[model samples]
Target: MADMNFTGPEPDLNELLAARPQLGLHAQDGLCLENVPLNAIADQYGTPVWVYGAQTMRARFAALRDAFAAETVPMHIHYAVKANDHLAILNLFHEQGAGADVVSIGEFLRATKAGIAARDIVYSGVGKSEAELETALSAGIGQINAESAEEVDMISAIAARLGVVANIALRMNPDVDAGTHAKITTGLAENKFGIAAADIPALYARASGLPGVRVAGIAMHIGSQILSTEPYRHAYGKGAEMVRALREAGQSVEVLDLGGGLGIGYQDGPGLSPAAFAAMVRQATNGLGVKLMMEPGRYLVGPAGLLLASVILRKQTGKRFLVLDAAMNDLMRPAMYEAWHGILPVDAAAFQGMATPADVVGPICESADQFAKDRILPDLRPGARVALLDAGAYGAVMSSAYNARPRAAAVLVDHGGFELITRRQEPEALWDGEIVPGA
Candidate 1:
């Protein structure tokens, strides 16, 4: 495969993550991404692993929640469990009095299992299974962000079958293009996510007036990994407008969901502070007179976690490549988004050793498994440990068993103590249900 061209004005990873909140550490810490004591973990649990800071997760949630307290409209900081489904992380959010915004029944189970009450879980997804509906209703889930008119009917019908009315919310697609990566944006008119704005009113009327459903409010989640607040402004403005129209048509639109796109800085990211993003949101819905629900996936956890990998090889001569044990299967954003994630030496060897610019690639068989096509690094050897910065959100959650490589183990570090949250997967574990067709 041919090498992609790289030149001009590339961001300074060393300086950017050095100052960002989620990625920043105490001065002279000499680490980014995990910023954990890599030497300690490597000796204890080995490399190519994931670790999260529980205290950081709690702090970020509290920061976002506190920012909107002045609104007087009431709010719930629902942790989108899809980001990192570790029970420790969910339990931490629970202890902070946060709720869970789940997209699937599995996540629903995880939140509840992690001590979150069923009433605190809010389910939202485009294609939900029927069993998921029954499970939520039986579990007494607080609300459902219904994405379609059919889903509205289905939820009502499912509740009817279960003899309990399910709480519901209309996931309105204000058609606000959350200007972000194409793979993550979902609120546009044609995206297969929420229902169109034009049809939400009638759908709500049907669900609210129906016998087996409680119309709680309106919800909208445009996309994920969103860095700008402009899309949120557009979403809230348009959503509030819809809420007003619905109220005039004899509907009490009590909840307004701006949908979480508040992104953490990755790839020379200029930190997106939770407090700042929340304050911006506060200004948008200042007098909307509705309780706000934000389904944040990345912002809540992205900065709190890091993926630690060991450099396996460094090739030079032609378009240099810094190969690491972590591949596309480990963190897919690089290959998927041409994304920029600040990669740092756990030891800051680049500072003490010779400096050079080279592509940080992975050991994956494919050429696309490269993390940074041309990144500056302090000449690395095979054993030096490095980290992928701002990986707390979509990092481990998106890893796959590609190339039959066993998924890495996941851990959490809190109060300077560490615990293994998810065990390393074995190759045979992937074939848990193996059986010959003839047999």
Candidate 2:
């Protein structure tokens, strides 16, 4: 598994700024994303807000698409909706001719709401309720990646009931090590993600003869935060071999849904090169003659969004602690996966302050409600703001109202200005739908 932490000294503030060109230190204003200053948004909407750069996302999508095109690799890019499900974010990708890779009906609805055609969406998940399957089928979904034999049967039954031929793909458990964090890895034998490789042959044959289903192809997702292509080379090589074997058995294989887990640099470094990744993919599946599809979540949006937080207080305990109003409920990656995110001050003056070690934490009651431990950060006084970098993916969508702290507001920056995408949640709204024993 790839270690999420830096063994040596973390990159200095300027190094971090240099790595992400979208952000910069304004001479008079503060840290700016695109053209709007981070301090400006923080001052207006308050801290614990999310700000996403529209141009950053646009550039990233173009780079990924162009890399594949450069390698002469024909593939469809499905923006993974679970990363950041905000409608504005979805619409931005859709405008760039990207489809959606959804795992639930809610996400499917969000995609369609954002003007993504139903035919462009791919539904993938292990536990799709009957209602969810029916919804996707009725709405004319592009493909459904079935993870198990029972799910295949369930899809068949629902499709037959609806009188529609559901396009399906057998998700193969290639059991390849993605070399990512263990908690996010999904393709191993012990994980409950997909059908075992040994069992795919028999199941594929059986599903081929089933009613109300068209077996389009095979799909596999090894894991998330995958920084290298070695695992993909191994996994796709197995997938291509399976495609050949299935064809020899008189089964049709049309699409290869190479599930996405492309990683980004959380620290100040180029995490993964799109050109290298594309070249490796081209070599791995060189003459497969199958329609290719990839579902990239973090790679596209992770670097485009950031969490703006304010220093609540500086506690000088056994270890220096910089507590912010934002908690684990707002950004769970650190608490959940021990993830590393670049922490930089929003003020231009503070951006160049003397570095000192401090534990960046939140007000959440949990012991794990920390973002960085002993992180070298500038001297941020109480009320000073900082931007938690690379938070566009698996950041807000995974947020909750834990500790009854209202979910933070969100903003989208573009064209030298910013707009409020989601307003701060009102605390009373937390219990609005509750039934208090008929009181």
CA RMSD of each candidate after superposition: 3.0, 1.4
Worst 10 residues of 1 by lDDT: 1-10
- Point out where model 1 deviates above 4 Å: 1-8, 11-13, 21-36, 70-73, 437-439
Q: Note the residue pairs that clash in candidate 2.
A: none
Error of 1 at 194 (Å): 1.3
Against the true structure, whose lDDT is highest?
2
TM-scores across all candidates? 0.92, 0.98
Can you write out model 2's per-residue Cα lDDT over 190-210, one digit (the tens) per residue? Answer: 898999988988999999999
Off by over 4 Å in 2: 1-5
Residue 435 miss distance in model 2 (angstroms): 1.2
TM-score of 2: 0.98
